[model samples]
Target: MSDVKDRVLDAAVDLFARQGYDATSVAQVISRAGVTKGGFYHHYASKEALLYEVYGDLIARQLTALEQILARRLRPADTLRAVIGDLVGSTAASAQRALVFWRELHRLGHERTEEYRRSRRRYHDAVQQLIADGQATGEFTAVASPEVVTFTIFGVINELPLWYRPDGRKQPAELATELADLVLAALEG
Candidate 1:
């Protein structure tokens, strides 16, 4: 993305998170981005188009993190914990965008939803592979199916934004380690 387009997308993400999709306006985005109406229109045909770009960027970032986790060679249990740690650790840096994506992007329709689903499936597949590895290696016990294991981890980590304020109570690394331990305990047979 060009600098101007990047600005527009960033502004849109913030506005969508704060005021919601319906409540935000193109004019507001333009103002936030310090771009003219013409510049905004040059980059995005409509507000929905801008939102789609934002969603695409977010999904790409997540897939990249998952790939990093998968590339690590370690014990299955260690790998699972490491992957969860990677997730939580990366999420801390982009928590704002992730939170916005989680909270609002579902308002998108079937086609966009399907695109997001595809990206998410790749992410889940990586995790599933790790779980299967764990089961195969016998280092980690598998009481539940890999799909179930994936879903459980998703359920917990995806909810982090609901209660994850950056107060002095817990640092990102601390929270991630705690979450990794909890997930490990649950997955272990």
Candidate 2:
């Protein structure tokens, strides 16, 4: 992406997080990005197109991180712990953009919504495969189907951005470790 496109995405994410999809306008995004309307149009066909670019970037980062962690061949339980720990830190560092991604995906209509779902499924499949690997090796006991377990774990991990506040009192890794324990206890035993 060009610097102009990156600026537009950054500004779009901040505006969407603060003002919401319905409330934000293409003009506002352009102005905030400091790009002319022609430049914005050159990069994106419309507001929806711009949204997809921003969302795709977020989904790519998440999927890449998961792939890197699972590729390490760690124990299933340990891999999950590290994955969730990374998730907590990533969510803390990018809370506004994460929230915007979630909110806009939900706010989008059927066609664009389906695209988001596919991107989501790719990430979910990676985690489910890790769980299946663990189960096959007897590293993890399956109390629930891999799908169910993956979804539940993702639900817990992904919701952190909605409620997490960065205070000097607690660190993201510390909170992630606690969350990891809960996830392991629920799925492993």
Candidate 3:
């Protein structure tokens, strides 16, 4: 992305997190970004589009991270642990955008909303599949259905932004490990 575009996105996420999508204006984003109207328009069609990209980009990067971790071919337990850590760390680092996203995601048009959901589903499905595969291999005991397990995992992650503090004494990595350990314990015995 161009420097101008990056600035616009950063500004949009900041403003959206602070004021909200319904309240933040295109003019505010333009002013905060320090970009010309033409420049802003060159990258995003509207405030809605920018909002979509804010969440879309975060999910996209997360999905990509999932793929990379899967490719490492670790045992199911280790893979799940790494994935949990990555998701937690990434969300904590970008909690502003994550918060803005979950709050404002419904504002996107049907098509873009569906696009985001599909991408999100891909990530969700991958995690569920890992659990199922582990069960099949006898690595993970069948303590819960993959659907429920996946739900529990994502439930904590999705709600993380509301309470997680990046500057807090407990960092993302430690929290990630704690979460992973709890999940792993349930699956193992």
TM-score top scorer: 3
lDDT of 1 by residue, 1-189 (tens): 789998998898889888998899899999999999999999888876777777577668778866776677767777777777777766666667677777777677788788888988988998898898888877667778899989988887787766777775988789878878877887773
Ranking by lDDT: 3, 2, 1
Give TM per candidate. Answer: 0.86, 0.85, 0.96
Off by over 4 Å in 3: none
Error of 1 at 91 (Å): 2.3
Q: Lowest-scoring 10 consecutive residues by lDDT in candidate 2?
A: 100-109
* Residue-by-residue lDDT tens digits, candidate 3, 58-150: 888899899999999999999999999999999998888889888997798998989988998998899999999999999999999999999
Error of 1 at 84 (Å): 1.0
**How high a TM-score does candidate 1 get?**
0.86
Clashes of 3: 0
Candidate 1: residue pairs that collide? none
Candidate 3's TM-score reads 0.96
Clashing residue pairs in candidate 3 (N, C-alpha, C atoms within 3 angstroms): none
